[model samples]
Target: MVSRQAGLLLAALVALAGVSVVGGEVVDAPPTLTVENDGDTTYRVTAYTVESVEDALLTNFRVTTPAGENRLVTYSQLVWPAGYRNVTVTDSVPSQQVTVPPNEAVETEIRVWEPGDVTIYIIEEPDDETHVWSDMKACTERQQEHSIRLRDGYEGGGSTCASDLDLLFR
Candidate 1:
């Protein structure tokens, strides 16, 4: 009877959640993107940022790999025509990107270092204090209008959805 209910629903998903189905597909539920360097400085990514909270900082694209490769990029989200809308426009995602092998209930692993190029900003906001104002300023009289609206050009869907991912640290 339908292969005995698909073999009792794949043996109750391999005895409850230790799933590893074959042919029916579910080998460890893959959908990954794990990059770890653990020091020895090699990060040559130069791009990867997707953490927005209603204001901006969402889309920025450009990927023409093949001049020495390093590719790993994926983004799908963009549909926030807020307030009174009638949208059905397809093609423009970034509502909240970056979740490759990283979804601790929607990502949050802050790490920042400077000296040009090595960006991996993916913090699906909600840690409060209005999009995490640096140095943890709970409130300081509007902290200069929230640091001048967090340095003005907050960057949302810029390039209207470019695309990138060159996280190479080998």
Candidate 2:
């Protein structure tokens, strides 16, 4: 009877909504950050600005690439303390263009262009946003990172990224 009751409890928990799983710790889904390159090159770039604890842009820190490549991207460099909170986080990326391989998701890194306390959030490509963002704990942190490569003549792609709940409430 005890075993049966435990199974039932597990089923009840599974039925609940808004549960996510991340790094073995259950958390809500993260937001999606999307980007596109509409120029004539083999690489592309996207930029996002992380907000300060007051939900305003923190201008103290500057973002740049250590590598000399013109294709380097510094999407996330601003950092924040663990307990830091912000009700709103806004992102801005100026329009740019480039070319990429056809139907491939490339792997790359965005280091700290400027040193600061900011959380890095990269958008996921070719994923089910609805299912991923479902209220489940097993889906919090991303398991792997990948980005879609636009083929010649392809227009654009849509993606999203989720933020920690602490930031949402702040």
Candidate 3:
């Protein structure tokens, strides 16, 4: 029932108060980890390092490709169309420690020639290590928070740290 002049005055007052009353979709930030393809050849899980990201946060990323060739990739930025196998940590890797200054990661790689499975494990028990863990937290989709702790060993579903990181990403 407001007149045009009154509505304009109200909008001006709202703008002066720095309030936005517009109805619009609220976008969420993308996760640090996502499944992506490397060039035209392979897929990779890239951990995006942003300013809000705390350094030395344990993200025990593991990829166990039983059949195809796999590796720790740093440079590929292409977002592979949402199709991935969700590989795990397996086999053995003869990898040189390559640091991508932007990604801030240390990784392992392995390839299996024979048909049998290759079991690979990475970054174990952050608590047992000399590295200091920050008070990073994990939160569920419901927005409940939990403490981030690395287990003595990776108990299968995912590495403890990776699982917690997944939680935080939600």
Model 1 lDDT tens row, 55-124 = 1233432222334332322222222211211112122432223222221212222222111211232221
Give me the displacement of residue 152 in model 1, in angstroms: 31
lDDT of 2 at 4: 100
| Candidate 2: segments with Cα more than 4 A from true spot | 1-40, 46-56, 59-103, 107-170
Model 2 clashing-pair count: 30
* lDDT of every model, 2 decimals: 0.25, 0.30, 0.25
- How far does residue 148 in candidate 2 sit from its true spot (Å)? 7.0
**TM-scores, one per candidate:** 0.19, 0.26, 0.17
The TM-score that candidate 3 achieves is 0.17
lDDT of 2 at 11: 51
Q: Mark the 10 consecutive residues where model 1 has the least summed lDDT.
A: 139-148
lDDT per residue for candidate 3 within 1-170, as digits (tens), equals 56988988866754554334556422222222211112222112212222222211322323323343343321111112111133222223322111222223223322211112112222211222211111221221221212111222211222222232343343
Q: What is the lDDT of residue 47 in candidate 2?
A: 29
Off by over 4 Å in 3: 1-40, 46-52, 62-170
RMSD (CA, Å), each prediction: 19.7, 14.1, 17.4
